[model samples]
Target: MAAGHYGLSNLIAIVDHNGLQIDGTNEEVMDLHPLDAKWSSFGWHVLMVDGHDHEALLDAYQEAEKQDRPVVLIANTVKGKGVSYMENQVEWHGKAPSDAELVQALKELGGDPS
Candidate 1:
């Protein structure tokens, strides 16, 4: 695994745990509960946050920077945030948007999906 072998002791990998995998759901694939303990075992300080809140993210980054060791900011994000039919739905995980979909998505994202 790249994680275990890539000198990642000094790295902070913020995995987006939305409870969905490439398949149907995360529970169907693996039981990744008690996730903090798992990553701490890998020598990282974990901090969970609200993935959509800008205020929380800013605070988390500030705290993470103050840490002496690697700090994983595990922000739980939706599959398609700011979208009408997609947020938290696993169907759009790897699918790209069509021209029509892109326009709709942009409007949902304050007319800017950038």
Candidate 2:
């Protein structure tokens, strides 16, 4: 709100809303629903996008750049996105991958081990 009042049009906030935490889902850990309304109440121009989609992310940024007020991009995503064993799993939130797991995860993401 203060940012808007001070007229900081260049400020851009991107929130990654991947519901998982080390404890559990964000709802189970601590609910922060109505996120859209929350930022709007703070006088920001809010936009939601699929956090995984590069095109969508780029488009959202472009749209945000046009706003006179500060922009808040709320990107909804999956934790540990590309790995089969880690995707949407809260356990992986703070866990480091084993060597085998790293290989598998990289394979799933189509990245060369070299």
In model 1, what is the error at residue 60, expressed in angstroms?
A: 1.1
Task: Please write out the lDDT profile of model 2 over residues 1-114, one tens digit for every residue.
Answer: 898787678999999999877788879988889889989898899999999999999999999899999999999999988899999988888889988888888899999865
**Best-fitting candidate, measured by lDDT?**
2
**N/CA/C clash count, model 1:** 0
lDDT of 1 by residue, 1-114 (tens): 345445454566678878887777877788798888887787677899988889998998888777666778888887787788788777788889898899889888888655
Give the 10-residue window scoring lowest on summed lDDT in candidate 2: 1-10
Model 2 has an lDDT value of: 0.90
TM-score of each: 0.82, 0.93
The runs of at least 3 residues in candidate 1 whose Cα sits more than 4 Å from the true structure, single-residue gaps closed, are 1-10, 112-114
Tell me model 1's lDDT, rounded to 2 decimals.
0.79
Candidate 2's TM-score: 0.93
